[model samples]
Target: MINKDSVESAYCFLHQKYRVYEFSNSETQRDDIEFAIASYVNDMNKELYAHLAKGRKEFLCNHTTFAADMQEAINELELRL
Candidate 1:
C-alpha cells in the first residue's frame, strides 16, 4: 500500500529542493538530465516509456527496496509532474 506519510515526506523534500522546477524547464530538464545520465535513470521517461514499458527500469542499478520506498518515489514523481 502507498504510505501517505512517506510519500508526503518525499514530496516535502523534493518541494524544498526543486521548488522552481515546475516553473523552469522541468520536463525538458528532466529529459535532459536523464539523457545525460541515461545509464543511471534507466532512461524511462516519456521518450522511452513507450518502448521500454517492459523492463523500463532494467538499466537502473538494482537495489533493494521496501514497498514504501517505491511508493515514495512514485509519489514524488507524480507530485512533480
Candidate 2:
C-alpha cells in the first residue's frame, strides 16, 4: 500500500523549500515564485509516477482523483495570478 504519511512528509518538505519565498511586492517576483513551485511539483509528480509499482500506478490512474483535482487547483491559481 502507498504510505500516506511518507508522501505527506515529502510534500511538506518540498513546500517548505520552494513555497517559502519571501514576497517582494513585485508582480515579476510573484510570477517567478509561482513558476518555480509549479515546476517543482511537476518534477515531483514525474518522479513519483516513475517509482510507483504497476498496481499503484493503476490505482492512481483509475481510483484516486488527486491528480485532476490538483491540476484544476493549479489552473485556478494561475488564473487568479
> Model-by-model lDDT, in order?
0.39, 0.42
The local distance difference test score of model 2 is: 0.42
Whole-structure CA lDDT of model 1: 0.39
In model 1, residue pairs whose N, Cα or C atoms come closer than 3 Å (at least 3 residues apart or on different chains), thus clashing, are none
Candidate 1 positional error at 9, Å: 0.4
Q: Give RMSD to native, each candidate.
A: 11.4, 10.8
State candidate 1's TM-score.
0.28
Error of 1 at 6 (Å): 1.1
Best by TM-score: 2
How well is each residue in 1-81 modelled by candidate 1, as lDDT tens digits? 334554454345444333443345666764443343334234234433332224435332223322233344445456634
